[model samples]
Target: MGRMGLFRDAPQGVAAVASSILACIVLGTLLERFGPGNVHSGLPTFGAIWVVTAAASCAPWNYALTRFFICRTGATFVTLDANQFTCSLMVVLNVIGTATAEATEWGNLGHGVTQILSILVLSEITIHSGMAADTAWRVSLIVPAVFCLVTATGLKLLRRNTSTAARLDVSVTGKITKSLLWDSFEVLKDFRVVVRIMLYSTSIRTELAMNNQLTTRFRTYFLMDAADVSVLAGSFGLLNLVPYLCVHYVDVLCPGHLG
Candidate 1:
């Protein structure tokens, strides 16, 4: 996309990403803070339960929102095949890869910046606010919730102002068919797809497990207090911005090759 196209698409992508980061941070922090203490030298049973429950609860809502709302919005702005009642996973990824690639990159850059801000906020609340850790964590949770509300409001305003010249007035009028479900499974028949799924799932699980244990590991192994841990996490967030910076330069040098 050109500079104008990137600017036009950026708000939606950044808003979506910001909302996701806020949700993950709140849920992850809750699991770390309030889940039962470890009984053994691994992930606590209750923490695992919390993670599982969160995932389960989110899955249905995610499916509904993607199928009913997001896809409908996309279809309004872009033509879809007549037989395609809803966007498949590949279609969604293709939209992200092409139309919103630069905007998504900016969104990721925003995520790293937000992470650092959140860490600093957490530190300020827990370390300098003269509040108990229990109370401070709860207070810190409010920050993300407020940010989410602001993002939602901004999105609403953006929607109101968005031009409808190319809009198709599309609505999701079809039910989820058995054929659709089977078509989704068809992707699993490919060996490469299966292997990719396994690798992605394993990496995600490992990342979550490590994140759940990060504070405990720092406290136990390094004798770091909450303040020190926050500082370290903030440092990681700062380091995370480096890749996004590199991405901008790479895109500048190679243009359309980024996606």
Candidate 2:
């Protein structure tokens, strides 16, 4: 079956329902696998590494696509921004949040959930499932390498898209700079905005560094059984978000809890 269009006004229920089903799966993975599947052996290890790599990389790709599609393109800004914020949000959350949680206890769990959902769905959408992983893995390596290529392509195609809603209202009558490394301090309109962005970046880096080791560290230090670790991880994830999803008013009020 064909997937839903990017711009179609999917009922809020769809996103919510989809998000719920995803929660069950992630927590279930934790419950079933226990402590990141055994990789001490051969084929299992290969598959386990594949899973790990996928876990490491797929999430970022997924987030990027979502942001590109939803927020960046603004859900098919075929005429407007063409930015696809959804696609961008995925990458931002995944990069800043998922891949390098090298710093924390619950490390990347929050961002992990978001990336998993965005990528899995996008994978299933753009590429067929059987082919998605292979395609993703190939694309995963040297993400930074193809990063510009893909972004450039997206931008080029977007300009051609009559449906795009261009976010940058400013007319570019001048020459375009090929340079990517620009100073953030120079770009910021105000010092306060600069401070906010800096503080925000610092807080995220701090959280990821300090409280991100929920899986690896726990598994090592406690020497817990695989099942035990999985159960613990699952329990934490479940308690972290599941119950709130079950609540109506509570979730609507505190959106972060559901995430």
| Highest lDDT against the true fold, candidate | 1
In model 2, the runs with Cα more than 4 Å from the true position are 1-180, 210-212, 231-259
Per-residue lDDT value at 245 in model 2: 31
How good is model 1 by TM-score?
0.43
Instruction: Write model 2 residue lDDT over 52-92, tens digit each, in one string.
Output: 33333334334333322222211111111111122222234
Best by TM-score: 1
Question: Cα miss at 98, model 1 (Å)?
Answer: 7.8
Model 1 residue 145 lDDT?
Answer: 47
The lDDT values for all models are 0.38, 0.33
Q: Please state the error at residue 14 of candidate 2 in Å.
A: 38
Tally clashing residue pairs in candidate 1.
0
